[model samples]
Target: MTASGDGEPRPFLVAASLSGAADADWARAAAPHVDAAVLGGVALDPVSRAAARDLVARGRSEFLPDDPICWIDRGFAALADAPVRPGVNVRSATLEPVREAAAVCADRDAVCEVNAHCRQPELRAVGCGESLLREPDRLADYVAAAAETGATTSVKVRAEVPGVDLVAVADAVAEAGAEWFHVDAMDSERVVAEVTGDTAQPRADLTVIANNGVRGRRTLAEYAAHGADAVSVGRPTERPAELARVAEAVRAWREGELPAGEPPDRSEASP
Candidate 1:
């Protein structure tokens, strides 16, 4: 899990949320500031790709390209010149499509994230995103298939999906051998902490990345205290000042200067 000899975890990541085709462009500009950039929420298979293309055609999508392969490839090229690690966040329902996308990521030596977080009706209708929450078996199979490709496999989960046992969901993903579990902690940081604590105490092999509403170094430290390996910024990255502040915080934290709260007791980490 350590990317270096010192056994230090990698710096905080910028979770996947760069829209469409222009994700590469955004990553190029943001690369110097973050440790990694996940280039997409890109649709890979023909059905999802068609939906993305249709959105672009209808002027509904600002940064997506009409051609699926071109869209992904262009983003890849953008990351090639980036100053940080490049990753791709892909949305798909079936294992074959994810395998195809994972192959592309493997070719580029980039991370491939399985998106189970998108809430778009169009995506849900196609059995992606929140839809997968109800189908843990399928989700496990999907991540397992992606991992078999030998690309770094990650799964983005929405922490509070209705009626879904997210902890169980995470266990299934980990059991399937996903190296990273990216949690979109929608209004519930405690849930993220619970998941992180559970994964850490027995076997901290899975890298738990806490996402959503992480605004500053304090919040970053807070998540760390909760056992997250890292915290991520999403909408806040749209603000330059906020992004700069977060970057500085990450630097300080990495250098062992950012003040962090005492790690939370795992018993209190219950969701």
Candidate 2:
């Protein structure tokens, strides 16, 4: 399905996490329960080739083909036949490659995410990840360039990065015409709240997807109250049972049927 309509509470977003294609499978299995699936932190530069080579040299990422785009495409295709709206998060050091990658998503009818949330050392070293958090101007330019591709654009940002003005960053992205703002709220719902609030250049079409430690119906409700158009769960959704539980909570929260209480105990969700 296409993304949730404006002002409507989205079902839920399976975060752009690192669970291989298992996350996509979870989305497919949970299709009756959720709204969207963000596929990857797919690297969009030559460094991706090097990263793949390193993984190949280490006998890891074995399921990944040599081409990173193929790896991303395979993940996207998994959800193509499912009802969940698909999105792909891409990390890039420059604009040209982001546009190229966004084009790929446009062709597949998937939103392309500019990933400023990844803090991997290799990615940061090359200015592809959290590095963008330190450069809001460049991040705006990157999102603007990607938006020009005509694919729906989403900017995924890590909100707790020291010295980064997340609200300013989000405002820049929204002003650049990004359709969605995804904030990895880290430890602060306040950050998500501030970013989702009306800014000097607010776009009524902009949707906020809040990502972080969403444990149960209560937590999901909290994010929604804090202004999240949708709430996303990352690592916790890897297990089918956990995914089911979160899906149940999301459904309950959406219907205002969630039992009033503290957040559900998530002891078993830890890896």
Candidate 3:
């Protein structure tokens, strides 16, 4: 989805995982409903493995296809389980090990997002992913490097940053040829209430994707109503059947229909 300078409609990202084999299936099921997809993995690929071996100091964790690398195999395994073709909410971003990993996505015309939002400390000590969010210049540099690959580069980042305004940081990343702005919003009742009426400026600009604590149709609709372009979730819709239900709910929200009430009582769909 293209965004005008003043902000545009929200977009979607089928946030899935490398470890959760269900993500691929969920992605396939959710794809038709959303705008794009991001295959979230918590580890490093082989090349990243070598990079970590070289660059990381002692005790640094290797951020691979997943933070644990075990996630990579799981993610690929999930891809194997998909019945319908994978689709998603907004733009798609997959974990890459080297330029070649990016090339694979580019060759297939698949969108790959850089995982800069994960906050696991193992990744932080090594100076990758979420840790880099604090360094916009580094984040920008990473985006620039990813951009050079001829593959569309987008970043998944958290809402709060220590040094930069989350919104401003998102704006800067978007300005640097980054196509999608993935925002992981926590489930705060008061915050949730304000989202729908919070539209000001650039907030609407670009594709603003809301993530984090979305549980069921009601919560999904709440964010959509509040101006979310699309929403990427994990627990509530990780299976095909569940994804279908969630997708229908998302469609309902988009069309002006609201789910009966607030979202279901799901305290587990945490970040």
Compare the candidates by lDDT and give the number of the best one: 1
Where model 1 places Cα greater than 4 Å from the true spot, the runs are 1-9, 50-66, 199-203, 262-271
List where candidate 3 sits over 4 angstroms from the true fold. 1-13, 18-37, 40-99, 188-205, 239-241, 259-271
Record all residue pairs in model 1 with backbone atoms less than 3 Å apart, i.e. clashing: 21-63
CA-RMSD of model 1: 5.0
Q: Per-residue alpha-carbon lDDT of model 1 for 1-271, expressed as tens digits?
A: 3452112246566645656443767777677667777777878776776555666776656344466556666678767766766677887755697887777777777778888888877778888878888899999998888888887888888987889988888888888868788888886778876786664432357777888766666767777667777767766556667677778877776777766675433332212
- TM accuracy, model 2: 0.84
Error of 2 at 153 (Å): 1.0
TM-score of each: 0.85, 0.84, 0.65
Which candidate achieves the best TM-score against the true structure?
1
lDDT-based ranking: 1, 2, 3
Please identify which of the two predictions, 2 or 3, would achieve the higher TM-score against the true structure.
2
Ranking by TM-score: 1, 2, 3
lDDT of 1: 0.72
